[model samples]
Target: MGADERERLFQRARECSGHRRTWSEADRLWTQVIDAYRQAVSGSGRVDPNDRRQLARALWRHGMLLAARGRPAEGLATGREAVTIFEQLNDAAARDATDQGRDEALAELITAVLDLAETAFAAGEPVLRMDLLDRAVAAGLRTAGPPPSAGPRTREAMGTAYHNQATALLHRCLTGTSPDEDAREAALAASRACELRQRLMDPLRPLSVWEMANTYGLYAQCLTLIRDLDRAATVLDLGNRLVELLGPAGAQPALKLRVAATMLARERASARGGTGQRRWGWRRH
Candidate 1:
């Protein structure tokens, strides 16, 4: 079956299973989607550029996931293929290729770079990660020309790219058997991600609860990983508070779960040490 058909089947399964229940159907479809993408790249001449870009994005994401799940070589190679397609679209000067073609392709390139970075990181190559991220940011500047406006595709893509890069840096630092300097750099990178997300949320005005919660939640988690538990707790609260406002527009269950987990993690961290004092110490001390 085609990717769309596979997606339809997955969605149907989800709908039948009730959105709340765990179902492997979606996972199966996504797997098929990634497989299809890889196959297309082998004979990419038949695929249209726009379709190639979308499929490339899918392949990159799934490849990273597979890498994280322990197929680093396959995942990294898939990411590399996707990166090539993203570069082509980014070089395009037409809307047929990008919704905001100029910046969209750039955003795609940024995304591809981030994927490559993560895949490389998983494969134990920090130097590769750093190099890809550097190119991602530079290419992003060319394609992502302006700050985000409501519904502006490029802006969101840019924000996503920034968040991805920062998160990769966070993982690289946290998981390494490394020196303090490396950890410190990772913390700083995560902080930059937090700041950029804050700005992205602000301009949209009356930001949705989901958006606020996710942004703050990621910051909280990053802070927690860096041993800044107190700041993490505060950010976790901010994220929870936004849930009420976000109720109307609907929210993503996955992000909601992350928010929940962050709150639990904060409490756990607070309880571990001189509980009450650490709760408010990071900012002051």
Candidate 2:
């Protein structure tokens, strides 16, 4: 098929994938899109950079669809392929003497890595999830550059990556064998996330406010884990204030913030030598 034809197919697949009812058709169209790209590459005896990018995009969408449709393992494999292609593209972009498209390529790479990490998490592969999240964070940092210099998209992606890393670490800490080490790492990740979100904050954007508040809650939880009771309390207070800004919409996060506050208070009491209290004994949400 021609490039135009393949693009039309991909667009159709994208539209279909956006809705729940047409997912099966979307899957079929994505397969045709991939097949067309493969045929074109095979006939030419080489892969065009744009073609590789389009193929990777198709694979990424298909992987997400599969995962949403209850085929997580298959989705994970497909997502891995997509991430590999994006990684290759990123490496090539880094090598280009002209310095063309490097940031765009890195952004895409970070996105693919994060998406694949989510698939891995859904597939119950925490180790792979953590590794991919770490890669996403690294790529995000490269894309973001120095403070106040990164574009809005770059900052948002970096914040998301850090928040996800912190959340994943905390989950592993709660469920796995290593609590102390993971909690410390989680604290660091959450701190970065909070910093990025702070830069991104705007009172006009309710979603941004909500995200910052949620991140604050997560940061407080991390602080509590590390026995930083005073800091946790302060963070929780900030989170609660953000929640108040949301009015009724913040009810759920407000409850979570309250719980975090209680946990912090308990930790403080324990720090003062309260008996029969477990250190780092916050309930897992």
TM-score for candidate 2, please give it.
0.84
> Model 2, range 36-69, lDDT digits (tens) per residue?
8777667646677889889989999999899888
Alpha-carbon lDDT, every model: 0.60, 0.85
lDDT (C-alpha) at residue 217 in model 1: 59
lDDT of 1 by residue, 116-143 (tens): 8878878888778788877776665655
Clashing pairs in 2: none
TM-score of every candidate: 0.56, 0.84
Cα-lDDT of candidate 2: 0.85
Q: Which stretches of candidate 1 lie over 4 Å from their true place?
A: 1-48, 54-65, 94-99, 145-151, 171-188, 199-211, 218-236, 243-285
